[model samples]
Target: MEPHAPAGRLAARAHLLAAAGRPEEGLPLLAAASGTTPAQHWAGVPWVADPTLGPRIEPGLLARTVMRLCTAVGDPAPATTVTSLRPYLTVVRHAVDAHGEHAMLLGAGSALARRLGEVRLAVEWAGRGARAQPSKLGEIWLGYAYRSAGRMPEALAALRRAVAYDPDDLSVYADVAATLADLGRLDEALRWTELALERDPDFDCVVHTAHRLRHRADGDVEHLVALADFVRDHPDDAHEHTDLEECCRNAAWLGGLPSGTPLPAGRAPVNAQPSADALHRLQRVSGPAWPHPPGAYDRALGLVLVEPWELLALLAHPETARAEQQDGLEVWACLGLLHHGTDEPWLDSSRRRLLLGLLDGEVDRVTQAALFAMVAYAWVDPEAREDVAAVVAARLTETASGANARAVAELALAAPGLDRPTRELAAATIRVPAAPRQRGRGRSLLRWRRD
Candidate 1:
């Protein structure tokens, strides 16, 4: 039902007045109007009291409410306001749920809670949303929330969904690709990432994914050399350094070393700028900080693939001189240990020590936990892959659990010497036997024989 006409007019004027910089006058009018209803004089105005309110409800309002609450006086009733907008929420929730069975609904709802700084609530809603909608976007958000909230199976399911739904949403391919890397789904992630780049060759997303694809275990070395050549000749474009570093890291991870080419290392890429080679989108989504530094994050990607030399080269470059570089360095060290046998000597040794030394220092808790995971992974003996897997399994149980953590645990079980408990844990993580692993002629490099 529509709100009363007079109330509608007042709400619209209040919204306009607020937008036009006359909130003082507009607020009183809204307050006067709201005073006559069951709703209190929020903003001294009748919110959504307009006749068009039903058709006008959108996620943007949730974002607006979040911004407003952040700037408002003592304790904005965000939860109440959101709940009161039920009619609109119902419409959106129903539509999204109907499309894919409630999977993506959590994403929309979680986004609403996330914007309002309700992180825990955001995670819960995102889980629900993904379970409801089952779309790529839904899975992406669900995985993101699961990772953030410490739920691995849910996170993996979401990420797997994202990969499965690709070529449909190019914008999300980068995230799905990255998640695949973290999960050690290398060949598959590379295939889809390449597809995304093919679809949008000049788009920054493609550039980013291409840089990563060249470092897959089965990556094309010739392309890596060519990309390196591209950077060598295009020295004037300092931004490409990030991409160059990525190429180098990917090569190193895939068992190739970066050419000791002596181009002067450039300055590190800034998080605020839209540089060509950042690993993650630097724009703040709904939190106080972006997930990780793009370059550092890229380095983390390299680590998972066993590329310590590239990480070392990047760390030594002047661009990586900042404190933020430490995060990538730490991950690189950890991944190096896990990818190559830890018994391999002189690889990321110093970086590992540096990270360990900083354990008691001023790093953030989340960062610290991540570092610990890397350290634990590194401590695993390659010959005793099962032993390493056991460590991850124990860590997963001890920790609240997240996507990466769960993935690590699963990888441990798949390790050569996995015991019963670890195997059981891994089994529990997968809700169903994965779809028959698909293979093409080139996919032979990924068969069980290789494993």
Candidate 2:
């Protein structure tokens, strides 16, 4: 080994320690090597001129080593440490720009910014990286930034581009499904999710999002049950636990049960038997206007015809078997039961409860907003409509993202009986500038969310 090989080996070990979640243990080693001269550090390592040599401690590698150490320290490190490390990122950026090597620095910088919650900066760096060297990894980072910033359309566009570049990337497919779901294109989202599953059947992201899309589109509880089972089997996957918890909470709330209700276990059994009447109904309305009036018997029958298991689950009274007295209203709500022609007292009361839950901050903003949008056509009470309109309008004002503001505005417009003042408020809220759209070539790549 060369005289400087010790320093290079030490640096490499430090990087490994940090990567293995023992960043503190790696700090001293990194510090010990800090005083080593670059010449000494690269003494044994071979440069490009020596083609026979295996590897070398090049400037790019050294720069990356420093970055990895800084990153492992995380975002809450001392101010002096952070300040000292900032120049190293600049060094990597300059090296990439000058020599067109070390392109991974862009991704590293973007990841670091994202970790620190500096989404706009992350987008900027990821875009630079992509332009420096277009790769699936860079596109994925850019897509994540776009999604985080609530630029769903652009996010979808970028993720789709990534898929085109690397069709086998399961993560990209999952992202596409998620973005589609956010856009309220549930059918398409489900399709993309199915494709993701085809690629990687056990991918947690795809599975979780698939179940979510199923629930949103058709209120399928079997998906929730499947998720619960998955969580039970894989206690180590934190994301699965989160998904299961969220699904259970939503299910309990919708079922009028305590939020802590134990989740159902195992996969739902499959049975393929449809009544003649159901088949006839499905044939009648399986055309363009399928989602007819919410409370219409035909509509309920139509959903069941399309998804036979839904009707069986409803008939079996799974909630009652699992818990106390079953509230059919919750089931109806889950099935997207809406009051057509005339509003029933039960529908009115349930809608009011959901709306009040939103105002009280008891419900998640996204779920509540979606529910309101779905039932807005039937919400005709002047006072109730005004209350909902006011809340939505206020939410729009408080939201910082153009995408969120647009969502609120769309929800407000969907509401059926909005008075003139409330309507004006919702309309005015849309004009609020959230973030400037990107202009010029590669400009969109670095679009930032402005506060």
Candidate 3:
């Protein structure tokens, strides 16, 4: 075989640095070797010059590789490795044009671009995916990409198209509700949340959506009370940890925090100007989450005063925070507030990586509690539940304290496909409330809509 190209050599060195615990130093190198621009990466490639380039990549091989790469990246991806893989994949993207799962590939590309805060690239991939063929995943991702790009009306239309594709998929309803809430249409959003709940009350997406919307609209302790009601109804379930802990944390702050604060008017997604990097997309999904230098109302919901990552970092390193910043009551209450209620991309990679790293290392009680409360929230997509469940269960065995242990145990039990031993341990440790009998489905849609 020929010796590696200089670009390949540069990429290899970057990966070596990351593997050696010098990830910060490696990031720039990896980004550089990838050429830092689509034009540079795709330049002179036969596939790019002509869609008719001969000898297309074997469809099955390309699809499987792309999917495996997706799973490997996970939340809080191995930063340098992911950065390197991205442009390399883009160069070969058109090579798999004939693949049956080409649409999925494009959707995955859109996701990577979105994570990097490249709004136009994200939307472009989604559009290509949707144009490649009409697919449920394609449409859902396109809707999501549009939402990220601040094209609210188009996002809604695409998401509704997804609903039209499969009304039985409860999560889609929750997505619709979330987008409505983004537009400050709480009533319509709530109706959609209820629509999902009536179909299946246990749905996690709707549950998170309901909590977020209720908290934003009511702007009171009542949202916390509502979460308490759910926790009481299903005590051992880990799915409630984020919501439950948030409620408890907020209840602690109700006395000190001010109320009746005026809120900024909502902006029209349509009127937003385009930028080269699309960093505005980041500001939209969850506003300037770290530092939150503007304080309070700067957050999307205005309920929590501190960024989730900042709270975790402060809790993890109280020695670094000032006396006043240490407790961060409002921060604790609002940790994961913005992202927990939504699906992927909104949660973002940096936050996911930080939370996961904290879970493995030592931290104070407050941080540990925060970690247990929000980990599952980051891993919100039901499709990835198995991986998230494994992560929670492994953490459960290592932790044997009371508060954090119970939270971890309950979270582990709540996950689907958990092993028997993990379930037994979680159940044996505490007395969770008996699950209420499930309500009958097939309720009147007309009544729900009219109400």
Candidate with maximal TM-score: 3
1-451: candidate 3 lDDT, tens digit per residue:
1233355555567667656755434433444444432223322322223343211434444444444444435422445444445543453345445452467667766665665466797788789888888877788989988988999988988999999989998888988998988887889999999888998887766776788678778543335444544544565653323443443332212212212221111111121222312222222323112221112223324323334434333333333333444333323333444343344453355445544544544323333333433433322333444555566677777764433355455445434445677767766654653233222221111110101
Q: Give the runs in model 1 whose Cα sits over 4 Å from its true position.
A: 1-60, 63-109, 112-119, 131-134, 150-153, 162-166, 198-200, 213-451
Q: Please, what is the whole-model Cα lDDT of each candidate in the order they appear?
A: 0.42, 0.48, 0.50
Structural similarity to truth (TM-score) of each candidate: 0.31, 0.39, 0.42
State the lDDT at 156 in candidate 2: 87
lDDT per residue for candidate 1 within 348-384, as digits (tens), equals 4444443343232222222333343342333232333
Model 3, residue 12: distance off in Å is 11
**Sequence-dependent TM-score of model 2:** 0.39
**Candidates 2 and 3 compared by TM-score, better number:** 3
Task: Name the candidate that leads on lDDT.
Answer: 3
Candidate 2 local lDDT, 114-222, one digit each (tens): 5445678767877887887888877887887777677899888888989999998776787899898889887899999898898777777778778867866754444
Model 2's alpha-carbon lDDT is: 0.48
Judge candidate 1 against the unseen true structure and give its global Cα lDDT, from 0 to 1: 0.42
